[model samples]
Every structure is written in structure tokens, then in C-alpha cells.
Target: MLKRIISGLVGFILLLTIVIKGGMALSISVLLLSLLGLYEFNSAVSKNGIKYVSIISYTFPFLLFLMFNIRGLGLNIQIILFIYILSILSILVLKKDLLLNDISVTLFSLLYIPFLLFHITLLDGNKLIWLVFITAFGTDTFAYFTGILFGKRKLCPELSPKKTIEGSIGGILGSLLLSLLFLKIFNIEHYVQLGILSIICSIMAQIGDLAASKIKRISNIKDYGNIMPGHGGVLDRFDSILFTAPIVYYYITYLL
Candidate 1:
């Protein structure tokens, strides 16, 4: 318990530092995080006896970041899709055994970890960037205590037996309250939008958490990695953020 708290504090401080120092600092931080997350994910998948092409597994994420970071590069969606299709075709040609599984898992990792997380950079210079962290961490904190105090029914026994339905409700309520507070703090009048966003983000965060838990269960591992001592790994810690960032990005971009 002490280790978890200490690690959480240190991680929060580092995250805040990167968020405040947006620009190259944020980009570099996301790049490193994406790399580490991909490493953890790839390692877990490999244990399932799924093999991936080393070059594609590592290089594609860097390419994704480069595409996002370098503006006007003409490396738009169509081009990116082409590259992925080409990569998969190459895998099919070169590796005949388990080609479909290899391609699917590799592509899933690319979309899941780096591609989704890249939206944080897209949210640069927005005050709502902090909301990403708030929604994720707030849900987690509230869920933990709520489950401990009033948890009777399991949320999803198969995926995560520790979670509870009451805890999930608490998490959403917590996120909504935090969102309202943030709106007031920023002097934004879009109360309804913020409320809706909070609900969506909280649900997405829980789903993200369950998804990671599912991965670990299938991999037959306890945690993604042991980098964070009490926390599992970068993926384990930021799984919720992975889903929330993209949702918030699109919401703020189009709706708000």
C-alpha cells in the first residue's frame, strides 16, 4: 500500500511536469511512453505464442509519432492505411505460418497503444488537456474507495473481480463532479457538454481498464510489467488515459 501511494505521487508529479511543459517536452514524453507501452504489450502478446515481425512492431509506432508531429507531411490517413496494408501483405508473403494472427495482433497494438495515445499531442495548447488526466485518475480513485466500502456485486468477475457495480457508478459520479469543477475553474459555460463528456470518458476509462485486465488474464500474467513497483507498467497505469484522451480530443475539437 505504501509503495503504491509513493509511486502514484511520483508518477503524478512527472505527468504534471510534462503536461505543463507542453511542446517538445510533451511530444518527447509521449514518444517515450508509447515506446515503453508498446514494449510491454508486445512482450505480453509474445507469451501467448503470437509472433510479430520485430521491424514492424518497433518501427511503426515511431512512424506514427513522426506523422503526427511533423505537420503538412502529406502522410494522411490514406497514406497511413496504405502503409499498414502493405506491411500486413508483406507479413503474409514472408511469414506463412500464423500470418493472420500475427498481422492482427501487431496492427491492434499499433492502433491501441501509440495511435490512440497520440491524441494527447493533438490536444496540445488546450486547457482541457488536464481534463484527460482528471477523468482517468478521478475514476480510478473513486472506484477504488467505493468498491472497498460498498462493493458487494462484482462488476465483471471474468475480467476483473475486484471491480464492483457500485464502484463504477461512483467513478462516473466522481468524474462528473471533477468535470464540473474544472469547468467552473476555467470559467467555461458549457456545463452540459462537460457533463456529457465526463460520463463518456468515465465509461471509456473503465472499459479501458477492463480491456487491459483482460489482456493480462489471457496472457496469464499478473501485471504488464514491474516498472512501477506497485503499479504494473506504463500500460497498466495509463490504460484509462489511452481511451479517454482520444475521446476528449474529438469532443473538444468538434463539439466544444
Candidate 2:
């Protein structure tokens, strides 16, 4: 418990620093995290003893960052789509020993970790980015305590035995409360819209947590990495954010 609290505090400080010092600071931070997450994911997948190439895994994240930052170059959606198709075909042809499963999981990791997380950089100047953190980490914090206090029935016994229905409800309520506080602090006056978004983010955050757990179960590993004393790794810590950020981004972008 002490280890968890210490690690959470240190992480919060670092995240607050990067978020407050947005721009290249935020970009670099996201890049480093994406890279580390990719590394952890690749390591986890490799535990299944599947042989595959990681060249694209390493290279495409930079390309994704570039694609987002270099807006004036007129990089259209079609071009990005073509690049993905070409990359997949190249992998299928060149990597003879690699099977369909290898290509699928590797590509999925690319899209999952770095690709989805790159949205944070896109939200560099927006205060709503904080909502991403609040929904993700806040849910996690509340769920942990709630589970310890009143966790009775298992939420998903196979994926994660520790999770409970009570904990999940606590997480949602906690996320909604924190989100409302953020909205009030920021003086944003869209209670109806933001309220809906908070609920959606909370539910999605839990799904994201479950999804990460499923990955670990399939990989037959304990944690993604041991970077944090109690939290496991960047991916483990930010899995909820990865799922929630994109949702919040699009919500604020189109809906609100």
C-alpha cells in the first residue's frame, strides 16, 4: 500500500509537470510513454514465444507523431490508410516465419499503444486533457479503495479476481464526481454534455482495465513491466487513459 501511494504521487507529479508545460514537453512525454508502452506490450506478447519482426513496431510511432504534428504537409487520411496497408503487406511478405496471429497482434499493439495515445499530443493546448487523467486515474484510485472496503462479488473472475461489482460502481461515481469538480473549477458550463461524457468515460475506463487484464491473462504474465514498485508498468497504469482519451477527444471535438 505504501509503495502504491508513493508511486502514484510520483507519477501524478510527473504528469502534472508535463501537462502544465504543454507543447514539446507534452509531446516528448507522450512519445516516451508510447515507446515504453510499446516495449512493455511487445515484451508481454513475446512471452507467448511467437517469433516476429519489431521494425515497424519501433518505427511507426515516430511516423504517427510526425503525422499529427506536421499538419501543413497535407497528410490526408487516405495516405495514412495506404501506409498501413503497405506496411501490413510488407510484413506478411518479408516475415516468412511470422504467422497471421503475429502480424495481427503486432499491428494491434501499434494502433493500440502509440496510435491511440498520440491523441494526447493533439490535445496539447486544451484543458479538457485533464479530464482524461481524472477519468482514468481517478477511476482507478476510487476503485482500489472501494474494492478493499466493500468488494464482495467478483466483477470478472477470469480476467481479474480482485475486481468487484461494488468497486466498479464506486469507480464510476468517483469519476463522475471528479469530472464535475473539474468542470466547475474550469468554469465550463456544459453540465448536461459533460455529465454524459463523464459517465461514458467511466464505463470505458473499466472496459479498458478489463481489456488490459485480458491481455495479461492471454500472455500468461503477471504484469506488463516492473517499472513501478506496485503499479506494474506504464501500460498497466495508463491502460484506462488509452481507452478514455480517444473517447474524450472525439466527444469534445464533435459533440461538445
- Write the residue-wise lDDT of candidate 1 on 1-256 in tens digits: 9999999999999999999899889988898889899899989989989886557767766776778778778676567867987977787897668568888888888889888898999898888888899999999999999999999999999999899999999999999999899989889878998789999999999999999999999999889998997998999999999999999999988997
Q: What C-alpha lDDT, on a 0 to 100 scale, does residue 56 get in candidate 2? A: 71
| TM-score, prediction 1 | 0.96
Model 1 stretches with alpha carbons more than 4 Å out: none
* Winning model by lDDT: 1
Stretches of candidate 2 exceeding 4 Å from the true structure: 76-78
Total residue pair clashes for candidate 1: 0
Candidate 1: residue 169 Cα off by (Å): 0.6
Clashes of each: 0, 0
Candidate 2: tens digits of C-alpha lDDT, residues 116-156: 89889878889898889998888888998999999999999
128 Cα displacement, candidate 1 (Å): 0.6
State each model's C-alpha RMSD to the native. 1.3, 1.4
**What lDDT does model 1 reach?**
0.89
Model 1 lowest lDDT segment of ten:
52-61
